[model samples]
Target: MGAVTSSMAAKFAFFPPTPPSYTLEEDEETGKLAMSGVPRRENVDVVRIKTKRATDVVAVYIKNPSASLSVLYSHGNAADLAQLYELFSQLSIHLGVNVMGEAPMLPYIVVRQVK
Candidate 1:
């Protein structure tokens, strides 16, 4: 039973999804992280929210969110903001609704010592 369990776990342990490629550069003057390669819309505001777990995540919020329902978009494990930024911007414009899209957080891995 132990061997079977270990084998099963091993299959998924290292087989995480491949995330999209993006570059984040901090401005030397403003000290703000510049998002490179992501499409930008005129009205949408890029903001960062800190989670209760002490992690910060990036989000794009359409203008005047109080007037409409917002979409809390969570990208798939294998994807990142760079790949979906354009899609989110289009959705907000075409759908005529406020859209808030968030980047995926890093997965938390737990290591156990097998005696």
Candidate 2:
């Protein structure tokens, strides 16, 4: 689809499920990052880029990547951005690069990365 309206963008930007906050709470006892009962790290930011084609939008969750580029994809093939968290974490650890994510808006710079 084409670009969304400013009104719609504002609505989703302030939606309950997705907000403009970068919060990662690490457990003092466990020394791990989590939100509620789930691990919070390197999760993909799913977007609706292909809303017209009805295909899943790609969101590459990479460690403090220097840059991000686009990739052409067919209708039914896509990777689960969230599911690759562990692997992305490993990549960051090995490469010694900070990891961040990009969805509809822009590539977010992770202020405090996961250790």
Candidate 3:
């Protein structure tokens, strides 16, 4: 039974032996790492949110944020901020709303209960 279940789980699992794409490296000058391979835009603000867990959540905010609406983007596991930077920027401009995109991570669901 265990063997059969293990085989079934492996057949349906989405784990990859290696990273799907994108490589992260530290900058030689600043020794800071950022998502590369995408065009970096100016005038974007970096906002960090501190969680109760003591982890800092980082996001990028486009210039001239809208007063009415905003978007909090959580990218898929196989993607990163570098890849979606342009799309988010365009969305902010086209939708006329501020966009906050969080970096992608291991696949998991985020459920926030309303008060």
Write model 2 residue lDDT over 2-96, tens digit each, in one string: 35687787666644323323333444565543322224445433223455746433344343454343222232222223444466566666665
The TM-score obtained by model 2 is 0.30
Q: Give lDDT per model, in order.
A: 0.60, 0.40, 0.56
lDDT of 1 by residue, 1-115 (tens): 9999999987776443454345554445654443556654567665556888787676666654443666778753444666667777778777767777776444432112222
- Best by the lDDT measure: 1
* Model 3 lDDT per residue over 14-109, tens place: 343244233444446654434435554664654445668766554566664454788888643333555567888888889888887865332331
What are the TM-scores, per candidate, against the unseen true structure?
A: 0.58, 0.30, 0.50
- Clashing residue pairs in candidate 3 are none
How many clashing residue pairs are found in candidate 2?
A: 4
Q: Which structure is stronger by TM-score: 2 or 3? A: 3
How many backbone collisions does model 3 have?
Answer: 0
Question: Which candidate number would show the highest TM-score if scored against the true structure?
Answer: 1
Worst 10-residue lDDT window, candidate 1: 106-115
Prediction RMSDs, each to the true structure: 10.0, 13.3, 10.2
Clash pairs detected, candidate 2? 63-98, 63-99, 64-98, 64-99
Global CA lDDT of candidate 2, please? 0.40
